[model samples]
Target: MPEQYDAIICGGSFGGLAAAQQIGGRVLIIDRLEIGDGETSASAVPIACLEKMDMTHVIDQVHEEIYLHTRRRTQKLTFFRFCTFNYRQFCEDLFARTGAEFVRARITSARAGRVETTAGTFEAPIVIDSAGWRTAAGKGGEKAARASRKSFGVEARQPYRGEGLHFYVGPSRGSRRFYWAFPAGDHVRAGLATYTGASDLSGDLERFCDDLHLGPPGKVHGGYFTSRLTDAVRDGMFLVGDSAGMCLPVSGEGIRPALVFGQVAGRLAERVRTGEMRLDQALSAYRAFVQSRGKGYRILDRLQSVLNVLPDPLFALFARYIATPRMLRYANRGYWNVASPDLLTADKAADPLPATAVPA
Candidate 1:
């Protein structure tokens, strides 16, 4: 007889792994790349997640605020504590805690309770589509061009350091495009992210790096992101992380939200696996959780619109005004209240995990 796990996680990134850990039953995670090699950058995550999971060893530096830059002026946005760490190491560390099986293969097909991969076929009562915006290897597929604000980003490490993370706004190179420089681990990571349209900012990454004076750029890489939040769960398929389109509309910041959705999905997965929650019940809970935040999401959408049309000076003023310590604190706490409620009360000053996981 063929053995089946309770859940099969597609795309072993942060959300997938987080789901697996919380699934609390037999599990298998599949990915296209090896586990330890997929770390990414210009990486910044709320400090609470690191401490919540007891994974702070991955921190490269702790920041008190971020620098928001524009053509006219730079604004200092002092938000809640942010930890810039080796995302790769954090990922590798996360997988270690999951007592689940992991396979390296490309997903050829996927549906509720079943997934086919180059390596073999997997069966389970539930399937999670953490396969990301590009993999589209799972359910509730990514949107079309206009509906989805596609993103391509590339980052290079330089031997420079920043006072704090620097975010360059406006379409320096492309529409819906932006640039960033952050002190990573020990050095710096400079990168550009632009929406897909007439602009091909692939080349602009280097120019932006050069203009920012962040030193010679290293290897360039990129990926796409969906702007709108589609159905979070469908059939017996649940979407987590970028698969759920959790990134901020204009900012494209997903790390922490990925963690949020993953936690919610994982908690639901465990209930489903244990026969405590039915498929529809789980789906409804997840869907309502997502839609509950729709108002907040719309507010961000409107703000992005204003940022796109506002004059340079006004935009700078808005950026500066929002970049203050008070505003930063509000942004951090407020954004999460609706976007990432899982960590609403998570404290980062100390390591606190009522339950446990392993780390790199």
Candidate 2:
């Protein structure tokens, strides 16, 4: 007899844990490292999307705004700008509370029904992949076509106000991308992001440091960032979070999309196990669901394109206009509804913040 579980989740990071917590079953969670050393290792958030999902235990702090900037535009983003996380602690707590078995084993190979790990072999009727930045099951080749220009970023907490998130746009040395500085408690998270094959960023870092008011020779790090989705759901296996390629392409924001998809994936995984849906249906459903929530991301991409076409100063002026407090508030409420499933109804009114008008 094949040793079985209701579900075997091949990851224990935020999205994996979230899926495990939402479902009912004996879940076996597996990962290469005992700790969350993937991108989840160091995540900065002004978490506005998952507020209604009841994962409050994982949140570390919430900020007031997401300050927006570009090479040419500076705006105060008053919506969805709350950074709250203790990635490692949050992952541990999810498993501990949910009573899911976490196996510290690297997944050597994964097929329709079998998962080979460092420890032993495991088989389950249903498998969900929450692995970040990888596809062990061999369904991700289509991702190459949807790839974004590779970019890099580094985040560190600096001594600063613990209230609002700030950003620096368009001062990097080489090709003009954006740098970010979100308030991480007392310290600030300052990092730069750019397309991978575009240009070398070493020269850009020097200019970025001066532009962002960070005087430094050795105080930062950078790496690739992109939100590429793949043909994820396959066979008895379902993919959620980064493994499913749910990161935001423009901003490279992964947490909100990951959590949203986690909820969706968990529900679908349960359905597939109980015979309510087939794998193709579930994958199609998830794809449609993500496309719905992806409106803002799509819009941002278009806006970025327009911004890129204009001269840098002109683009900055546009950003300055959009960053007014009122606009940020509208953006926050709009994106909040977008990220949360329960809040999207027509009758529901999003929260209103105090209005600050944009200059004409």
Model 1 bad stretches (over 4 Å)? 1-3, 135-147, 170-176, 196-199, 324-330, 341-360
lDDT of 1 by residue, 228-305 (tens): 666677546888877777766667677776776777777777777778889778877777777776666677766765
lDDT of 2 by residue, 20-83 (tens): 7655667788888774455432365445344454445666567776667664445665555466
Q: Model 2 segments beyond 4 Å from truth?
A: 1-3, 39-42, 46-50, 55-60, 69-74, 138-150, 159-162, 171-174, 196-223, 278-280, 294-296, 306-310, 324-334, 341-360
Worst 10 residues of 1 by lDDT: 351-360
lDDT of each: 0.70, 0.60
Tell me, by TM-score, which candidate is best. 1
- Distance from true location, Cα of 206 in model 1, Å: 1.9
Give one clash count per candidate, in the order shown.
3, 19
